[model samples]
Target: MPAPCHRTPSIKMVRGDITEQSVDAIVNAANSSLLGGGGVDGAIHRKGGSAVLAECRALRAAHYGRGLPTGQAVATTAGRLPARWVIHTVGPVHSRTEDRSTLLAACHTNSLRVADSLGAATVAFPAISTGIFHWPITDAAPIAIAAVLDTPTSVQEVRFVLFDDAAYEVFTQTWREWKQ
Candidate 1:
């Protein structure tokens, strides 16, 4: 493990559903299409309702017609969700042939920037890219923690919402080691 990363803001790790978090903003590990897909992306869109999708459509028509790029983050209304905003970011698929760690880190940093732009004080995030994207939790967790810690933002509370015991355990261990 690397040396502990010290951050000014408060970070919390919990095992829960990202969509249920009552924060100012929630991050969606969305596909590049910006349209709903499986896993976290699909759940968020399903739970947040049509208002969220409506804003997404507007974003697509105005700016992201070609789909959101990997590592870039965008904001949309939270709609019926407990949050005021949804920060959508596309995670890079893990590949043994190329180094894409920078893209993974950008997902967190860019999401935080978008959340800060919306004046969101509290933000919740899922274990991005660890799912169908195939990024190993061992590598992804540290990148996630470092990215959120290193980013300069107005966000006060950063909550990592891990979906399962394995994911939660990895994040918990990483968080402890990173804070050491």
Candidate 2:
């Protein structure tokens, strides 16, 4: 099969809370349950308000009864969030004996696809699977950047909203390396 045609978007990195990002959509590194869990998922749900949960529940009841699977994405109203929508994507748990890089890449690609479908021109993403999922930041950085760079989407900007200096540095360095 032919590889997908890639598009270049304005990629930026920031060290801050993702909930504070003012964009068209925020990508939540969510658990499969989609009800909310630790790390980025919990923060997004907490700040986004009950309206986000309500839509999640409705989605669960209407379609995702078994819960959202890893690497797939779904969208909900952002509620009180600065963004118009939240694209929830479940990333795979890292494994020492198994290579799950493809699933990690899928998380970013799927979220972008969801964002494009919603006509979101700018999107903010957290480091999916790098927290409690135990995926190393170094290993995850390339998969994420490559996925976002390679995917064809109408979105105009993609921001990596890192929670700390270390993650922000890693992503920044990766971006530099990719550009070279």
Candidate 3:
């Protein structure tokens, strides 16, 4: 049997790949180009099929070169996953000069804004920038959690789906502290 719904405006952290998750929507850490690339981008594209790319192509044609400033987001159909929508947000790559915290916060905020625009009640998020972007899971977790908690939307549930044990542990530990 399925687990009971907690029925609260709370964030839940779980260990798993975002592609395999069943939720209202999944957050895609996309490149500015919006084309499928490595890590979460590749996984979502691979599972969601070419249709997603086709749709993105259309969107890019209309909105390309406009520059979707960091932290802003757009939505498209899920294509293949059990979700109804895919919310794409751009995240920052770790660098010596960039404000990593601000960019990471933007990622989380933009995702929530997209979900809210779509009237989504639940959403799943991968640890943005924790992979190839190298934002460091330890730093990303708290910023992500804070962004989700800070959103004013009526979104009923938010999930942090970690791709590995280290990411999961970081999120779980941070969540524990945030709750108390």
Query: Between prediction 1 and prediction 2, which has the larger TM-score?
Result: 2
Q: Higher TM-score: candidate 2 or 3?
A: 2
**Across residues 18-85, which tens digit of lDDT does each residue of candidate 2 receive?**
99999999999998888998999999999999999999999999999999999999999999999999
* Candidate 3 residue pairs in backbone clash: none
TM-score result, candidate 3: 0.91
* Predicted candidate 1 versus true structure: per-residue lDDT over 17-136, tens digit per residue: 998999999999999888899999999999999998998998899999999999999999999999999999999999999999999999999998888778788999999999999999
Instruction: For candidate 2, give the lDDT of residue 170.
Output: 99
- Residue-level error in angstroms, candidate 3, position 17: 1.7
How many clashes show up per model?
0, 0, 0
Best candidate according to lDDT: 2
Which one wins by lDDT: 1 or 3? 1
Q: Quantify all predictions' global Cα lDDT against the true fold.
A: 0.92, 0.94, 0.82
Candidate 1 segments exceeding 4 Å error: 1-7
TM-scores for every candidate against the unseen true structure: 0.95, 0.96, 0.91
